[model samples]
Target: MYVCICNAVKEKDFRGAARRCSGGDAEQVYATMGKVPQCGQCLEDAEDILFEERQLCTRLPAANACQGLRGLAPA
Candidate 1:
């Protein structure tokens, strides 16, 4: 899905940038991607994607750690 038509940035592109960039801030991700919001219409959607991507990235390590602990706890 195209998030930013003006800059030709896709939803995945923004999500990738957001995951790579700290803070998961849409603006910062845009900066990292070498683009910025122009019409502002895509800002909300971009932020949503950024948040979702950040959440997924943050939870993975925790989930894996739990799995490792589960293996250690039973036997």
Candidate 2:
């Protein structure tokens, strides 16, 4: 589950970092987390995780998906 071999960062760590960088550039995430992208092999993996998180965040909230309650609350 290692995401950045150069920095010895784990996938979980990357996920957390991505969440924190939700409103900023991804490069800032790398810099703040001290993750150096050597050879760029892990770039795709990092981006994949970020993209997945972004997709999940954009989806309708679980409570909002319930029938007859779609507009009862804010997402």
Best by TM-score: 1
Q: Write the per-residue lDDT of candidate 2 for residues 1-75, one digit (tens) a residue.
A: 898887788888876776556343445557768766777788777777766655554564453222222222211
What TM-score does prediction 2 earn? 0.67
Task: Give the top-scoring candidate (lDDT).
Answer: 1
Evaluated against the true structure, the overall lDDT of model 2 is: 0.61
What residue pairs are clashing in model 2?
none
TM-scores of the candidates in the order shown: 0.75, 0.67
Candidate lDDT scores, in order, read: 0.67, 0.61
Q: Write the per-residue lDDT of candidate 1 for residues 4-72, one digit (tens) a residue.
A: 999999887776676566453577779988998899899888877766665565567455322212212
Which ten-residue region of model 2 has the weakest summed lDDT?
66-75
